[model samples]
Target: MGRNVKSRIESESQKNNLSLIIIILLALQVILSGVVLLRIVNLEKLIGGTEASEPVPVYVEGVSEGDNPALGPEEAPITIIAFSDFQCPYCASANQLIKEIMQEYPNQIRYVHRDFPLKEIHPDAFNAALAARCAGEQGQYWEMHDALFSNQEDLSIEKLNKQAEILNLEMDQFNNCLTTRKYENKILIDLQAGKEYGVNGTPTIFVNGYHVNGADREAIINIIKDVL
Candidate 1:
């Protein structure tokens, strides 16, 4: 009877050990599955980014006009319609880069500047854009454009007003335009246009209807040169 009892205890111990091993194996499988799922999600994001970086052709429908602030000749063979956010660092860099490109192909490119401010990220951006538009009313659009970019670090209402003052813009008129949101509708129209053109982010340049996203200076220059 003692020997039989001891053998039964040993069998039960073996069963408990087997159960613990199975539980551990199941937990490991779950952890491995989670890791694989996370890796797949990260890989998908990388693939999406890779696909986005490639340039796509966009059907841009609009005539280059004088109503908006523009540089270079309206009749130039290459038309560059740029959708930009003022407070964006990349946009600021692209602003300067575009200016250089204009200088390089002065007679060949008609550059149209449109406002596409990402107000969610840059709260002061819409106001800064309005400041530029108001300055345009005073015949100093480019002046204010340069000023805002130069002082991107300090784009408070006071700094914008200071920029206006520096540009010699009529304070009363500028203030009224900003206060009343005079160009708000126009800015909205530009944003809608950007959306129509599939502009997911700033510094989206349409070089004769070829869409180039981001601050790709070389790609922009090459596209213009190809058209020229």
Candidate 2:
């Protein structure tokens, strides 16, 4: 009847409408769970190496470098230092290419993988990295890393442990390393290095001392040519 009452009524109506909409969306989400899962599956296929169109920024690192220097040959003529997330699609694509390069060079090129798991977006990525680190302690880092990338669609802890088991790592040790935050400091250090490398996204790579400017990796090959 009065202005205050009208305002209160409107506010109450608004609250009720918002609540109703939220409930409806929640129902829709429930109904579309299968569709969501299907979409996640489809997106996984397009995850890495799908779009080679985005022009990436040319990166530079004055003091920042790759995370694991010990993973490759000490005398490698070319070093590809990369900061990547376990769950990122492009990271997976870069990894697939790097695998090919490794087989191609055998010993000439060193590929260093750094843990840059983006927790907010990909919660399972950090755990995957940690699990891989655990496997690394057992001389199976590459095994775990490959498994993670190969099965990027399922980066769950259950899946990570399954991968660890396949790598022959002791289950207890793997779980402990993941839950105890064993590689927390190392991950942080790698993130700092990523920052120094001027990385603002996953799959940021540097050849020698310069950043590969594009996601497609043609720029990476060019850098390698000049250095080699």
Please report the candidate that would top TM-score against the real structure.
1
Per-candidate TM-scores read 0.72, 0.70
Which whole-number lDDT from 0 to 100 does residue 89 have in model 2?
91
CA lDDT of every candidate? 0.84, 0.79
Clashes within 3 Å, all models in order: 0, 1
lDDT of 2 at 56: 50
Question: Which residue pairs come into collision in candidate 1?
Answer: none
Residues 123-182 of candidate 1: C-alpha lDDT, one tens digit per residue: 999999998999999999988988888778889989999888887788999999988989
Model 2 over residues 145-178: C-alpha lDDT tens digits?
8889889899888888888877778889878888
